[model samples]
Target: MTKADVTGNNHTLEVRDTEQTMAQEKPTLTYFARRGLGEMPRLILVESGIEWTDNRVDTIDDLKASGKLPYGQVPLLEYPDGFSISQSGAIVRHIARQHGLYGKNDKEAAEADMVFDGANDLRLHSRATIGNDTLREKFISEVLPKWLGFFEAHLKKNGSSYFVGHDITFADIAVYNTFYNMQILIPAAKLEGFPLCQKHFESIASRPRIAEYLKSRPYTAT
Candidate 1:
Protein backbone atom coordinates (compact mmCIF):
# COMPACT_ATOMS: atom_id res chain seq x y z
CA MET A 1 0.00 0.00 0.00
CA THR A 2 1.06 3.61 -0.60
CA LYS A 3 2.31 5.62 2.37
CA ALA A 4 -0.29 8.33 1.74
CA ASP A 5 -3.02 5.72 1.98
CA VAL A 6 -2.33 5.21 5.67
CA THR A 7 -2.80 7.91 8.29
CA GLY A 8 -2.95 7.63 12.04
CA ASN A 9 -1.05 8.38 15.23
CA ASN A 10 0.37 4.85 15.32
CA HIS A 11 0.27 1.49 13.54
CA THR A 12 -1.10 -0.46 16.50
CA LEU A 13 -4.34 1.34 17.28
CA GLU A 14 -4.87 2.18 13.63
CA VAL A 15 -4.81 -1.51 12.71
CA ARG A 16 -7.33 -2.19 15.45
CA ASP A 17 -9.58 0.56 14.15
CA THR A 18 -9.02 -0.61 10.61
CA GLU A 19 -10.30 -4.11 11.34
CA GLN A 20 -12.86 -2.91 13.86
CA THR A 21 -14.34 -0.71 11.16
CA MET A 22 -14.30 -3.56 8.67
CA ALA A 23 -17.02 -5.58 10.38
CA GLN A 24 -19.88 -4.12 8.39
CA GLU A 25 -23.60 -4.12 9.12
CA LYS A 26 -23.94 -7.78 9.98
CA PRO A 27 -23.95 -9.78 13.19
CA THR A 28 -21.89 -7.04 14.83
CA LEU A 29 -19.01 -8.38 16.94
CA THR A 30 -18.35 -6.57 20.19
CA TYR A 31 -14.86 -7.49 21.33
CA PHE A 32 -12.78 -7.18 24.49
CA ALA A 33 -9.15 -6.41 23.85
CA ARG A 34 -6.17 -7.92 25.67
CA ARG A 35 -3.96 -6.25 23.04
CA GLY A 36 -3.05 -9.56 21.40
CA LEU A 37 -5.48 -12.44 20.89
CA GLY A 38 -8.41 -10.05 20.51
CA GLU A 39 -6.74 -8.70 17.39
CA MET A 40 -7.43 -11.86 15.35
CA PRO A 41 -11.20 -11.65 15.67
CA ARG A 42 -10.99 -7.93 15.02
CA LEU A 43 -9.17 -8.62 11.76
CA ILE A 44 -12.06 -10.84 10.72
CA LEU A 45 -14.41 -7.93 11.36
CA VAL A 46 -12.37 -5.65 9.14
CA GLU A 47 -11.70 -8.23 6.45
CA SER A 48 -15.38 -9.17 6.38
CA GLY A 49 -16.50 -5.81 4.99
CA ILE A 50 -18.46 -4.94 8.09
CA GLU A 51 -18.70 -1.61 9.87
CA TRP A 52 -18.95 -1.79 13.64
CA THR A 53 -18.17 0.26 16.74
CA ASP A 54 -15.27 -0.07 19.23
CA ASN A 55 -15.85 0.20 22.92
CA ARG A 56 -12.87 0.25 25.31
CA VAL A 57 -13.27 -1.68 28.56
CA ASP A 58 -10.83 -0.57 31.23
CA THR A 59 -12.07 -1.13 34.75
CA ILE A 60 -13.90 -4.22 35.98
CA ASP A 61 -16.80 -1.87 36.55
CA ASP A 62 -16.41 -0.73 32.99
CA LEU A 63 -16.44 -4.30 31.80
CA LYS A 64 -19.43 -5.39 33.83
CA ALA A 65 -21.49 -2.22 33.52
CA SER A 66 -20.64 -1.69 29.90
CA GLY A 67 -23.56 -4.06 29.40
CA LYS A 68 -21.57 -6.66 27.47
CA LEU A 69 -22.74 -10.23 27.79
CA PRO A 70 -20.86 -12.48 30.20
CA TYR A 71 -17.35 -13.32 29.08
CA GLY A 72 -15.41 -15.76 31.26
CA GLN A 73 -12.30 -14.30 29.70
CA VAL A 74 -11.27 -12.02 26.95
CA PRO A 75 -11.06 -11.36 24.15
CA LEU A 76 -14.79 -11.58 24.44
CA LEU A 77 -17.26 -11.26 21.57
CA GLU A 78 -20.57 -9.55 22.00
CA TYR A 79 -23.51 -9.46 19.66
CA PRO A 80 -24.93 -6.12 18.61
CA ASP A 81 -27.25 -6.10 21.60
CA GLY A 82 -24.55 -7.30 24.06
CA PHE A 83 -24.53 -11.09 24.28
CA SER A 84 -20.94 -12.08 25.07
CA ILE A 85 -18.79 -14.98 23.91
CA SER A 86 -15.52 -15.82 25.62
CA GLN A 87 -12.26 -17.54 24.63
CA SER A 88 -9.86 -15.85 22.22
CA GLY A 89 -9.69 -18.82 19.87
CA ALA A 90 -13.43 -19.27 19.91
CA ILE A 91 -14.00 -15.60 19.18
CA VAL A 92 -11.52 -15.72 16.33
CA ARG A 93 -12.90 -18.93 14.85
CA HIS A 94 -16.46 -17.64 15.14
CA ILE A 95 -15.58 -14.45 13.31
CA ALA A 96 -13.59 -16.32 10.70
CA ARG A 97 -16.44 -18.77 10.19
CA GLN A 98 -18.81 -15.86 9.77
CA HIS A 99 -16.55 -14.05 7.33
CA GLY A 100 -15.13 -17.11 5.48
CA LEU A 101 -11.70 -16.62 6.99
CA TYR A 102 -12.12 -19.96 8.69
CA GLY A 103 -11.87 -21.54 5.24
CA LYS A 104 -14.09 -23.27 2.64
CA ASN A 105 -14.91 -26.38 4.64
CA ASP A 106 -14.75 -27.92 8.11
CA LYS A 107 -11.43 -29.60 7.43
CA GLU A 108 -10.03 -26.39 5.98
CA ALA A 109 -11.31 -24.49 8.97
CA ALA A 110 -9.70 -27.03 11.26
CA GLU A 111 -6.41 -26.52 9.53
CA ALA A 112 -6.90 -22.81 9.99
CA ASP A 113 -7.47 -23.47 13.65
CA MET A 114 -4.29 -25.50 13.80
CA VAL A 115 -2.30 -22.52 12.55
CA PHE A 116 -4.25 -20.18 14.77
CA ASP A 117 -3.64 -22.33 17.80
CA GLY A 118 0.08 -22.27 17.16
CA ALA A 119 -0.04 -18.51 16.83
CA ASN A 120 -1.91 -18.27 20.11
CA ASP A 121 0.79 -20.30 21.78
CA LEU A 122 3.38 -17.84 20.58
CA ARG A 123 1.34 -14.85 21.68
CA LEU A 124 0.64 -16.17 25.16
CA HIS A 125 4.30 -16.99 25.58
CA SER A 126 5.16 -13.51 24.45
CA ARG A 127 2.69 -11.95 26.84
CA ALA A 128 4.44 -13.60 29.77
CA THR A 129 7.12 -10.95 29.44
CA ILE A 130 4.95 -7.81 29.20
CA GLY A 131 7.66 -5.31 30.16
CA ASN A 132 10.52 -7.48 31.32
CA ASP A 133 13.32 -7.10 28.82
CA THR A 134 15.18 -10.14 30.12
CA LEU A 135 12.12 -12.31 29.87
CA ARG A 136 11.24 -10.87 26.47
CA GLU A 137 14.72 -11.67 25.27
CA LYS A 138 14.40 -15.21 26.50
CA PHE A 139 11.09 -15.56 24.68
CA ILE A 140 12.36 -14.11 21.42
CA SER A 141 15.83 -15.60 21.51
CA GLU A 142 14.92 -19.04 22.75
CA VAL A 143 11.22 -19.76 22.72
CA LEU A 144 10.24 -17.93 19.55
CA PRO A 145 12.87 -19.63 17.40
CA LYS A 146 11.43 -23.05 18.15
CA TRP A 147 7.88 -21.90 17.45
CA LEU A 148 8.66 -19.89 14.30
CA GLY A 149 10.94 -22.61 13.05
CA PHE A 150 8.27 -25.27 13.45
CA PHE A 151 5.72 -23.21 11.51
CA GLU A 152 8.20 -22.31 8.80
CA ALA A 153 9.07 -25.96 8.21
CA HIS A 154 5.38 -26.79 8.13
CA LEU A 155 4.62 -24.02 5.64
CA LYS A 156 7.55 -25.12 3.47
CA LYS A 157 6.33 -28.69 3.50
CA ASN A 158 2.84 -27.45 2.55
CA GLY A 159 4.41 -25.66 -0.45
CA SER A 160 2.41 -22.47 -0.11
CA SER A 161 2.86 -18.87 0.94
CA TYR A 162 0.16 -19.02 3.63
CA PHE A 163 -0.20 -21.09 6.76
CA VAL A 164 -3.30 -22.90 5.61
CA GLY A 165 -3.93 -24.27 2.09
CA HIS A 166 -3.64 -21.71 -0.71
CA ASP A 167 -6.12 -19.20 0.63
CA ILE A 168 -5.88 -16.92 3.63
CA THR A 169 -7.40 -18.07 6.87
CA PHE A 170 -7.67 -17.01 10.50
CA ALA A 171 -4.60 -19.18 11.08
CA ASP A 172 -2.52 -17.15 8.65
CA ILE A 173 -3.81 -13.92 10.11
CA ALA A 174 -3.16 -15.08 13.66
CA VAL A 175 0.43 -16.11 12.96
CA TYR A 176 1.11 -12.97 10.96
CA ASN A 177 -0.38 -10.69 13.57
CA THR A 178 1.36 -12.41 16.45
CA PHE A 179 4.72 -12.60 14.71
CA TYR A 180 4.65 -9.09 13.25
CA ASN A 181 3.26 -7.58 16.40
CA MET A 182 6.07 -9.22 18.31
CA GLN A 183 8.55 -7.80 15.86
CA ILE A 184 7.12 -4.38 16.53
CA LEU A 185 7.97 -4.91 20.17
CA ILE A 186 11.13 -7.00 19.71
CA PRO A 187 14.09 -6.77 17.39
CA ALA A 188 14.11 -8.90 14.22
CA ALA A 189 17.78 -9.68 14.73
CA LYS A 190 16.74 -11.78 17.67
CA LEU A 191 15.00 -14.07 15.20
CA GLU A 192 17.92 -14.31 12.76
CA GLY A 193 18.49 -17.53 10.74
CA PHE A 194 14.82 -18.37 10.89
CA PRO A 195 14.34 -17.17 7.33
CA LEU A 196 11.09 -18.97 6.56
CA CYS A 197 9.41 -17.68 9.67
CA GLN A 198 10.66 -14.20 8.94
CA LYS A 199 9.58 -14.45 5.31
CA HIS A 200 6.09 -15.71 6.13
CA PHE A 201 5.75 -12.95 8.72
CA GLU A 202 6.70 -10.24 6.24
CA SER A 203 4.46 -11.61 3.51
CA ILE A 204 1.28 -12.22 5.47
CA ALA A 205 1.93 -9.03 7.40
CA SER A 206 2.23 -6.82 4.31
CA ARG A 207 -1.44 -7.11 3.34
CA PRO A 208 -2.92 -3.79 2.27
CA ARG A 209 -5.54 -3.98 4.96
CA ILE A 210 -2.89 -4.66 7.61
CA ALA A 211 -0.12 -2.41 6.25
CA GLU A 212 -2.54 0.42 5.83
CA TYR A 213 -3.59 -0.18 9.36
CA LEU A 214 0.03 -0.19 10.59
CA LYS A 215 1.00 2.95 8.69
CA SER A 216 -1.86 4.68 10.42
CA ARG A 217 -1.42 3.61 14.02
CA PRO A 218 1.92 2.19 15.12
CA TYR A 219 1.24 1.40 18.75
CA THR A 220 -1.66 0.32 20.96
CA ALA A 221 -0.80 -1.64 24.12
CA THR A 222 -4.35 -2.34 25.21
Candidate 2:
Protein backbone atom coordinates (compact mmCIF):
# COMPACT_ATOMS: atom_id res chain seq x y z
CA MET A 1 0.00 0.00 0.00
CA THR A 2 1.19 3.54 -0.84
CA LYS A 3 0.22 6.31 1.54
CA ALA A 4 0.30 10.11 1.60
CA ASP A 5 -0.28 12.76 4.25
CA VAL A 6 -3.33 14.96 3.78
CA THR A 7 -4.20 17.55 6.38
CA GLY A 8 -2.11 15.71 9.00
CA ASN A 9 -3.93 12.45 8.35
CA ASN A 10 -2.60 9.39 6.60
CA HIS A 11 -4.33 8.58 3.27
CA THR A 12 -3.46 5.22 1.86
CA LEU A 13 -4.33 3.87 -1.61
CA GLU A 14 -3.67 0.55 -3.28
CA VAL A 15 -3.60 -0.20 -6.98
CA ARG A 16 -5.22 -3.26 -8.48
CA ASP A 17 -3.53 -6.55 -7.58
CA THR A 18 -0.03 -6.34 -9.05
CA GLU A 19 0.56 -10.05 -9.57
CA GLN A 20 -2.87 -10.98 -10.80
CA THR A 21 -2.91 -8.00 -13.06
CA MET A 22 -1.78 -8.29 -16.65
CA ALA A 23 1.22 -6.65 -18.31
CA GLN A 24 -1.22 -3.92 -19.32
CA GLU A 25 -2.19 -3.13 -15.76
CA LYS A 26 -3.57 0.32 -15.30
CA PRO A 27 -1.04 2.97 -14.29
CA THR A 28 -0.90 4.42 -10.78
CA LEU A 29 -0.53 7.98 -9.45
CA THR A 30 0.80 9.75 -6.34
CA TYR A 31 0.22 13.31 -5.31
CA PHE A 32 0.99 15.92 -2.65
CA ALA A 33 -0.84 16.41 0.63
CA ARG A 34 -2.72 19.21 -1.09
CA ARG A 35 -5.04 18.87 -4.06
CA GLY A 36 -5.54 20.44 -7.56
CA LEU A 37 -2.37 19.47 -9.38
CA GLY A 38 -2.76 15.78 -8.81
CA GLU A 39 -6.46 16.18 -8.34
CA MET A 40 -7.06 16.94 -12.01
CA PRO A 41 -5.06 13.95 -13.14
CA ARG A 42 -6.87 11.78 -10.63
CA LEU A 43 -10.15 13.12 -11.94
CA ILE A 44 -9.08 12.37 -15.50
CA LEU A 45 -8.15 8.84 -14.55
CA VAL A 46 -11.50 8.35 -12.96
CA GLU A 47 -13.41 9.97 -15.81
CA SER A 48 -11.57 7.75 -18.23
CA GLY A 49 -13.00 4.74 -16.41
CA ILE A 50 -9.49 3.51 -15.75
CA GLU A 51 -8.51 1.69 -12.61
CA TRP A 52 -5.77 3.14 -10.40
CA THR A 53 -4.55 3.26 -6.86
CA ASP A 54 -4.08 6.86 -5.75
CA ASN A 55 -1.04 6.97 -3.46
CA ARG A 56 -0.90 10.23 -1.55
CA VAL A 57 2.73 10.43 -0.49
CA ASP A 58 3.38 11.90 2.95
CA THR A 59 6.97 12.03 4.19
CA ILE A 60 10.33 12.23 2.53
CA ASP A 61 11.11 8.75 3.71
CA ASP A 62 7.86 7.30 2.38
CA LEU A 63 8.12 9.19 -0.90
CA LYS A 64 11.76 8.26 -1.35
CA ALA A 65 11.02 4.62 -0.68
CA SER A 66 8.13 4.42 -3.21
CA GLY A 67 10.23 5.66 -6.14
CA LYS A 68 7.00 7.09 -7.61
CA LEU A 69 8.85 10.10 -8.90
CA PRO A 70 11.51 10.39 -11.56
CA TYR A 71 12.21 13.62 -9.74
CA GLY A 72 11.08 14.51 -6.23
CA GLN A 73 7.64 15.78 -7.09
CA VAL A 74 4.27 14.60 -5.98
CA PRO A 75 1.69 13.53 -8.58
CA LEU A 76 3.84 11.31 -10.74
CA LEU A 77 2.39 8.55 -12.96
CA GLU A 78 3.85 5.13 -12.47
CA TYR A 79 3.61 3.10 -15.65
CA PRO A 80 4.17 -0.54 -16.34
CA ASP A 81 7.68 -1.88 -15.59
CA GLY A 82 8.07 0.93 -13.00
CA PHE A 83 8.57 3.77 -15.49
CA SER A 84 7.42 6.85 -13.63
CA ILE A 85 6.34 10.04 -15.39
CA SER A 86 6.14 13.54 -13.94
CA GLN A 87 4.51 16.84 -14.86
CA SER A 88 0.81 17.10 -14.13
CA GLY A 89 -0.23 18.65 -17.46
CA ALA A 90 1.74 16.16 -19.51
CA ILE A 91 0.34 13.22 -17.59
CA VAL A 92 -3.23 14.46 -17.81
CA ARG A 93 -2.94 15.24 -21.52
CA HIS A 94 -1.51 11.83 -22.22
CA ILE A 95 -4.43 10.22 -20.46
CA ALA A 96 -6.90 12.44 -22.25
CA ARG A 97 -5.46 11.53 -25.63
CA GLN A 98 -5.51 7.86 -24.80
CA HIS A 99 -9.07 8.03 -23.58
CA GLY A 100 -10.47 10.23 -26.38
CA LEU A 101 -11.12 13.07 -23.95
CA TYR A 102 -8.71 15.37 -25.79
CA GLY A 103 -10.66 15.84 -29.02
CA LYS A 104 -11.80 14.12 -32.16
CA ASN A 105 -9.19 15.48 -34.58
CA ASP A 106 -6.06 17.60 -34.77
CA LYS A 107 -8.07 20.78 -35.03
CA GLU A 108 -10.21 19.87 -32.06
CA ALA A 109 -7.14 18.86 -30.11
CA ALA A 110 -5.54 22.20 -30.92
CA GLU A 111 -8.58 24.05 -29.65
CA ALA A 112 -8.65 21.93 -26.52
CA ASP A 113 -4.97 22.67 -26.00
CA MET A 114 -5.66 26.38 -26.08
CA VAL A 115 -8.31 26.14 -23.36
CA PHE A 116 -6.37 23.67 -21.23
CA ASP A 117 -3.09 25.54 -21.35
CA GLY A 118 -4.73 28.92 -20.95
CA ALA A 119 -6.66 27.80 -17.89
CA ASN A 120 -3.51 26.27 -16.45
CA ASP A 121 -1.73 29.60 -16.86
CA LEU A 122 -4.57 31.31 -15.07
CA ARG A 123 -4.42 28.81 -12.22
CA LEU A 124 -0.64 29.03 -11.67
CA HIS A 125 -0.72 32.81 -11.52
CA SER A 126 -3.80 32.93 -9.33
CA ARG A 127 -2.26 30.56 -6.78
CA ALA A 128 0.64 33.00 -6.30
CA THR A 129 -1.64 35.49 -4.54
CA ILE A 130 -1.74 35.43 -0.71
CA GLY A 131 -4.34 38.02 0.36
CA ASN A 132 -7.03 40.51 -0.60
CA ASP A 133 -4.56 42.91 -2.25
CA THR A 134 -3.17 40.24 -4.54
CA LEU A 135 -6.66 38.90 -5.05
CA ARG A 136 -7.85 42.34 -6.17
CA GLU A 137 -5.03 42.67 -8.68
CA LYS A 138 -5.81 39.20 -9.86
CA PHE A 139 -9.58 39.45 -9.76
CA ILE A 140 -9.75 43.01 -11.04
CA SER A 141 -6.78 43.79 -13.24
CA GLU A 142 -5.52 40.33 -14.12
CA VAL A 143 -8.01 37.54 -13.62
CA LEU A 144 -11.29 39.43 -13.85
CA PRO A 145 -10.61 41.74 -16.78
CA LYS A 146 -7.92 39.83 -18.60
CA TRP A 147 -9.29 36.33 -18.19
CA LEU A 148 -12.89 37.43 -18.30
CA GLY A 149 -12.30 39.41 -21.48
CA PHE A 150 -10.50 36.48 -22.98
CA PHE A 151 -13.25 34.17 -21.81
CA GLU A 152 -15.99 36.34 -23.21
CA ALA A 153 -14.24 36.63 -26.55
CA HIS A 154 -13.54 32.96 -26.70
CA LEU A 155 -17.06 32.04 -25.75
CA LYS A 156 -18.51 34.56 -28.18
CA LYS A 157 -16.36 33.34 -31.02
CA ASN A 158 -16.64 29.74 -29.99
CA GLY A 159 -19.65 28.85 -27.90
CA SER A 160 -20.51 29.95 -24.37
CA SER A 161 -21.73 26.49 -23.46
CA TYR A 162 -18.65 24.58 -24.61
CA PHE A 163 -15.02 25.50 -25.25
CA VAL A 164 -14.00 23.02 -27.91
CA GLY A 165 -16.16 20.71 -29.98
CA HIS A 166 -19.76 19.66 -29.45
CA ASP A 167 -18.71 17.48 -26.52
CA ILE A 168 -16.66 17.72 -23.33
CA THR A 169 -12.89 17.43 -23.26
CA PHE A 170 -10.01 17.86 -20.85
CA ALA A 171 -9.95 21.47 -21.98
CA ASP A 172 -13.36 22.06 -20.43
CA ILE A 173 -12.32 19.92 -17.50
CA ALA A 174 -9.20 22.04 -17.01
CA VAL A 175 -11.20 25.22 -17.21
CA TYR A 176 -13.75 23.79 -14.81
CA ASN A 177 -11.00 22.96 -12.36
CA THR A 178 -9.87 26.58 -12.58
CA PHE A 179 -13.39 27.75 -11.78
CA TYR A 180 -13.46 25.28 -8.92
CA ASN A 181 -10.24 26.78 -7.58
CA MET A 182 -11.60 30.28 -8.17
CA GLN A 183 -14.49 29.56 -5.81
CA ILE A 184 -12.00 28.86 -3.05
CA LEU A 185 -9.53 31.64 -3.88
CA ILE A 186 -11.79 34.36 -5.20
CA PRO A 187 -14.54 35.66 -2.95
CA ALA A 188 -18.02 34.33 -3.74
CA ALA A 189 -19.48 37.84 -3.91
CA LYS A 190 -16.87 38.85 -6.46
CA LEU A 191 -17.57 35.76 -8.52
CA GLU A 192 -21.29 36.44 -8.36
CA GLY A 193 -20.69 39.69 -10.25
CA PHE A 194 -18.89 37.86 -13.07
CA PRO A 195 -21.85 36.36 -14.91
CA LEU A 196 -19.84 34.59 -17.62
CA CYS A 197 -17.49 33.16 -15.05
CA GLN A 198 -20.39 32.14 -12.87
CA LYS A 199 -22.17 30.49 -15.82
CA HIS A 200 -19.08 28.52 -16.73
CA PHE A 201 -18.60 27.56 -13.10
CA GLU A 202 -22.16 26.32 -12.72
CA SER A 203 -22.08 24.36 -15.96
CA ILE A 204 -18.98 22.50 -14.87
CA ALA A 205 -20.25 22.09 -11.35
CA SER A 206 -23.29 20.36 -12.78
CA ARG A 207 -21.36 17.91 -14.95
CA PRO A 208 -22.47 14.41 -14.02
CA ARG A 209 -19.04 12.88 -13.38
CA ILE A 210 -17.50 15.97 -11.82
CA ALA A 211 -20.57 16.77 -9.78
CA GLU A 212 -20.65 13.22 -8.51
CA TYR A 213 -16.95 13.29 -7.75
CA LEU A 214 -17.30 16.57 -5.91
CA LYS A 215 -20.09 15.12 -3.83
CA SER A 216 -18.15 11.97 -2.97
CA ARG A 217 -14.66 13.38 -2.39
CA PRO A 218 -13.78 14.32 1.16
CA TYR A 219 -12.42 17.81 0.47
CA THR A 220 -14.18 18.83 -2.75
CA ALA A 221 -14.98 22.36 -1.65
CA THR A 222 -11.38 23.43 -1.89
**Predicted model with the maximum TM-score:** 2
| TM-score for each of the candidates | 0.73, 0.78
Top candidate on lDDT is 2
CA lDDT of every candidate? 0.68, 0.73
Q: Candidate 2: where are CA atoms >4 Å away?
A: 1-24, 65-67, 131-135, 188-190, 193-196, 220-222
- Deviation in Å, model 2, residue 150 alpha carbon: 1.0
Local accuracy of candidate 1 as per-residue lDDT tens digits, 1-222: 543366534676677666765443335443444455557666666666555544435444555676553653456666654455767677777777777787788788778778777877887787777788888878866888788678878889878887777887878878777776677666642456867777777876577776765575435764
Clashing residue pairs for model 2: 4-56, 4-57
lDDT of 1 at 112: 77
